[model samples]
Target: MHAGRDASDTLAALLADWQRARTPYRADAHDELAAVLVLAGSNADVERLNLAARAIRRQAGELTGPDRLYRLPGGRTLALAVGDHVRIRTNDYRARKSKGARADVLNGYRGTVVAIEADRSVIVQWRRPGADGPALATEKVSAVYIAVGGLSHGTAMTVAAAQGLTADRMLVYGMGLDPHTPYAAMTRDRLSAHLYLPRNVLESDADRARHSAPRNGAEELHRALNAYAAILQGDRADQLISPEPEPIAAVRARQREAAEQAEVQKMAQAVFAAAMLETVTDPRRPHGLLGDDQLQERISAAAAQTTALAKVVEVEQRRERQQAEQVTAVRAQVHAELAGERDRLATALTALDDAAHRHDAAQDRLRTAQRKVTALEATLHERYGGRIRGWLPSGERARLTEQLQQAKEKLTCAARRAEAAGRAEQAALRQAVEVFPAAPSAAELHQRLRVLANPRTFASALEKESAARVEAVLPGLADQRRVRAARMASPGLGDSAADRQHRARQALAALTAEADYRHRLDATRQRGEERARRDPAAPALARSRHEQAQQQAETRRRAREQQRGYRPSTPPGITAEGPRQGYGR
Candidate 1:
């Protein structure tokens, strides 16, 4: 059993020395603490080192909570808890070693915490394996209590303070000095007074006796210091010291400024209201509120203006009405004048109508007279050698007088012939009377002759008849022959039997002569009339008339040909007549 304990102790020391050498002070302590804690055996010392290592690792931002695992350089791992043994480098002892010193003071060395310090230092019992014993046996052993200062000490102190540990002075091995004072504890006054000591004096056997006389007393003192440091560290951690009171003061000042602004706004609103009231009370503008006097004055002015405008409108309207009336009056006057003119025109028209009727009557009478004169002239011309001019001008009247003289002579010759016929009739009547001087009524005379003559005696008596009777009978008989002869001479009657027998031979010849004479007379009269209407001396106009006559003659010839059933033969080499043929032929 003693051998086993010695082997365990030697192993713990070697592991601690390896940790310190690998991670010196000013280097990260977390790795060093972790290595030592894992190497420590399952003893009270190992348990305490593990806890202290955890705190140091946490402060160095390595090991965190109880659930976190620590990894060693050789791949060994362990969970951290409270009260685990650990090894850490001493910051004060690093300056004492020579540059080339080959001593392995850190190698194979380990420490134990007797008590925790407020400054994150540990009261450690260090041991290394001795050459004369088993590996677990503690060959070299020492006890030192240490505190850290400056950046290195500050980091460790910050963690120890959080864990309720306090320390002002510390003993460190392998540091240039055995005991190091925390910068927080040393003042400028002490340094200026040269209140300094060597590591031997400060951490000597005599000083250790003075400082460590009562071990429990030192422990109690550390506990008291830890309580105070815990309070201070808590205040720093929560940032509670200066921020709380200053926040309240800032809130109060902000509230005051807001109130002052509200007061200023209230004054501005009052000023605005006052200005609005002033505007409302003004009177020069029509929209503003008016005082009583101003209102009355405006009303009076408006009334006067309205009256003046109404008068002007009325005057303009009256002028327009007057103009319209004038136009109507002018139109009426013009219409009246036109009506008067129309009446005068009607009277004149009536007068003209009467005069026209009278003129027409006179014209009708003149036409009647002229027609009578024309009839007389025609009668005179026919009976008097075609020249009678009683109604003609003087020169024409002279020619007509000659014609009248010739007509008168013809009348005288007709009278002489009529007288000769009268004489012949009278002579015959007288001879009859003379021969029948004793003539009974003619019937009685005829009866006497019938009685006197007998058949045998009549032949003898016919010779002896009275001369008076023969004269009377012979004259009457002769007158009867003349009448018969005169009847034969009339054109309307046929010749007597003797004459008819003789005239039958001459009838056609006489009819031909008569027709020829009548035709010649009609032709001569037409020519005379045409010559009087159209003078042959006017050859230009005459040629036109001749052509017109030729056209008429041609029309008559064609009519005659049609009546005679005549048709012209087609000309040689002509198939049908064209328009050219109508003109040329």
Candidate 2:
């Protein structure tokens, strides 16, 4: 009796019984816990609905302070009187998930009952709105929030059959707007009914129409009520009441207006599509759209652009042509200058080659002259002690001066002969150059001939000087040889022991006589001195003569001692008369 039927009337009867049999269970308590009505919906929609409920709770000062009101998606809020006995309960779907130990996909909301119905369904209002747009639109209607199966705008009872439980007011959703038994049962027994639906009504209708296809007797009742309501609000209500046809012109005008509206709608759709296309393709021309007319205009503009580019290209080509002509003239002038420079360089190269050849020939001649000079110097140095220096006696100096003068004269003659030979060599070289194609310059030929002549002149000078030096040195050589011969011929050079003995005896005799004479002189001097002292008046002139004679005698003795090389004493083993000749021999 309770499973598939409207449970409102059965629940009402039970509630009345419970009130009648009310017991004093809480005798010491003044208040009881209120039950919160919980609704279920899609997870995201339910979360947003929970947020709206929080907002409304803040605005309305928390209608259900401790108990909550969870108004989920496909569910709405209904404002009720303060005195109405409201209740809140946990949603059956959430309770099942909590029992299974799974996370709640939908949250619970607090609700209060404002009205009751013959069925068990109740009109529940919460603390907040389920969505922002509807909540804002009817936000001013602070005391009148409605719960329906659809959006807040003209909420309807669509899922009356699936409502199952009876409440104070209709709370149906997830069904179509077709004539169905569940929809009739939902709205028929209730005093005030509210419906909850999706954001788009037509989509909801399409979705639920299939499920509501099983119609019943409620379909005839619904059609009758719709006819009655249409007539009461219809535009031709007067004509319908009187039964007459409308004028032909008026019918046609109405048709025309409908057609005009359809055309306007088509044009608006096209404009919106173009605006969307431009938003994606061209931000600068947000309102521009591509069409046949626009494409034609763009083509014409592109043609003009092409023509402008062609004109620019033509101008550039003309300027390039003038530049080319100027370049050609400059190139011709540069070529002429380069030709003259090349000829000058060729002549300079020829002059350099000629100078190099002349320098080589001169170097060869100078080396030959230096070699000849070195050889002649070595020969003269070996023979004559060339370039004489240091202490020469007067006779040798005079000889050297005469010899040097003669050498100078000889050198002059040799130089003349060398000059003649050089002239002949120069003539031969000139003849050779004449035979060749490129004859050397006169200056170059003369310089080479001078180089060749230097060696011969230097050699001749060396020979003359060597001869002069030999002549100057010859007299000194003759004097040294004569002195050597005289020393060899002396007879004393061969004297032996007998001659030495005879000389010694003679020296001894001379020494004895000198001693006797010296003694006699000393006696005479002493006697004279005694006589002078005795006759103090002797003549000064006589004294001077006597002193002079004493000095003369001393000088003579020294002379005789120097002439004989022996002392007064004879050497050992020699007799005073002489040495014995045959003693050793």
Per-model TM-score on C-alpha atoms = 0.18, 0.20
Estimate the lDDT of model 2.
Answer: 0.37
lDDT against the true structure, per candidate, is: 0.37, 0.37
lDDT (10s digit) by residue, model 1, range 1-585: 001012223222322333333344324333233221222212222323333333333333343224323433222333322233334343333224545332233422343333434433333334334577423211111222222211111211212122222222221111111122223222212112111111221233444455553246344334333432443344323324555476676686566545534533343333323233332322222223333345456555555555555566567568647644654555455445434433543443344344445555555555555555555556556644434443445655556556556555555554554455445444443433343344434344333334333345533444344323433434453354466677867855544434443343243343334334334544433343234333333334345555776788899999998878854554445445633332212
**In candidate 2, where is summed lDDT lowest over 10 consecutive residues?**
28-37
User: Candidate 1, 450: how far from true, in Å?
Assistant: 99
In candidate 2, clashing pairs total 38
Best by TM-score: 2
Off by over 4 Å in 2: 1-320, 331-347, 377-585
